[model samples]
Target: MSARSVEVRLVKSGRTKIRYGAELLADDGVRLTVRAPWAGEGGRDFGFVRFEPGDVFTEHYWRDRWYSVKEVRTGDGMLKGWYCDVNRPVAFSGGELTAEDLDLDLWVSHDGATVLRLDEDEFAASGLAERDPEAAEQAVQALDELELMARLGKLTDLLA
Candidate 1:
């Protein structure tokens, strides 16, 4: 199929957190891949990593998976790292893809030496455990699985 523009909407607590346009790269029944530019304004420096303009994101989302993996790269095609988000399985309809963020994330650095689990405090504060224990547990499991893959230098397998 020819490339098409798609909007990616990230939802949290029944609200849209962020939305951006991307180019649909591929779709294989269960998985969808898209290419997008960094959606944040200016740059964000988290001490351990920085996301800026000119960065590219090759994002993969699965219909049967609890998480999405994004390969981040510099403008010149240099590898930066992978950013994984624990979320509900993605849904695509009306030319848009939507995912409900679970407030949990994993960041794997370029060399796979710095794997960080992020937003645990937020996840705890979100009260997901009280509201939906099963989803909360699945989110945690997804984060753990991503971390293990990063440490084992197998994170790319998901992208493949």
Candidate 2:
């Protein structure tokens, strides 16, 4: 293997088993490597990516973030995740992100989702204006972490 490449091992047998090298098929029928950089190395916390039932996974992180997609009772669909990479924006092909230009701005096309960046002032002035000051006020406070993520670049791209 190359210096940056690692071999993935198929621990369990199911639909996502592999007969070849370390590569294996995932429950979603997508082939993924168990050897992500986050999987620990040499007994140290290099990094680890482990997948399990219901489309869930336990992935360790290094310099980057981790995410997964799962299909449960309703059938496995893509899952989203975000960690320490808060400084950067996100994108998604599941939402068909945006235009494809020659620029380095590749946040779009990430799951084909369009995202609007909201400044702090804009967010303060934004939201529905209603007569019920309490309700409006509550709405503003209700803007939890998820809502804040929407205001960033493109968050939809972190799909499983």
Candidate 3:
């Protein structure tokens, strides 16, 4: 099938955090994959990694899963790492894909030597536990699952 353009919206607290265009790569009822270039204004340096203009991201989202995984690569196609987001299940409609950020994330270095869990403080302060305990639990579980996958060298399995 021919690839189609799609707009991806990452939402936080009922607001759109980021929206960018991507090329739809595949969809199998439950999951959707898209490839997009770095959408940031300039470059973001996180000490562990840097996201610049030529970076490319192949992102995977699931309708039933509580997280999304993105494979990050350099302009020359060298793998940088995997960035995983703990989010609500994704929805695709009207040529847009939307997912709500749950404030938890995991990052695995390309060589699998570095695994970091991020945004725990933000999640704890988000009041999600008080507002929706079930979702908060699921989000924590999802982050744990992703970390395990990264440690076991099985993170790529999700892409397949």
Candidate 4:
């Protein structure tokens, strides 16, 4: 409604497992912005990077099938690059909202130049194709669309 505090969960598809959680900062029904502590954990090995526990992230989530974009910033408000997760449409229920991280990701640089795609191999190895081919195909399409948006620099407005 009016940017009330809510719990946001990133849950695995068709399961009760929660991969991540954050505090919802704003919600206009169609889109939600959330803030959470930045844990320097990702699928890839990018060496050592320093992020304080209270380093805030403002993540934007759409009700549609677009990927969620997280604008990372330091605790003192320094800019960090965006980390986006390609996933299915978000679902909100009760006091919580959830999204399925499709295992495909796109990282856009702070200046929005260097867009890197991540976790294709992990997506392929996730057995989603064997479990649910149609959903897996949709995930691929979502990834393609998000990649194009990142390349065209259309994702910057999403954070604002």
Prediction 2 TM-score vs. true = 0.18
The residue-by-residue lDDT of candidate 4 on 1-120, one tens digit each, is 334556667766567555445677777888888777764463333432345566678888888764788887777888767788877788887767788888888777777777888889
Off by over 4 Å in 2: 1-74, 80-128, 148-160
Off by over 4 Å in 3: 1-3
> Order of all candidates by TM-score, from best down to worst?
3, 1, 4, 2
Worst lDDT window (10 residues) for model 4?
A: 42-51
Q: Against the correct fold, how does model 4 do in TM-score?
A: 0.81
The residue ranges of model 1 lying beyond 4 angstroms of the native Cα positions read 1-3
Best by lDDT: 3
**What value does the lDDT take at residue 27 in candidate 4?**
79
Per-model lDDT: 0.94, 0.26, 0.96, 0.75
Q: Regarding lDDT, does 2 or 3 come out ahead?
A: 3
Better of 1 and 4 by TM-score: 1
**Candidate 2, residue 22: how far the Cα is off, in Å:** 40
RMSD of each: 1.5, 17.7, 1.6, 3.4
What is the per-residue lDDT of model 2 for residues 42-159, given as tens digits with 9 covering 90 to 100?
Answer: 3322132223333332221111212121111111444322221111111222311111111111111223243322233533453324334563443344333334444464343333
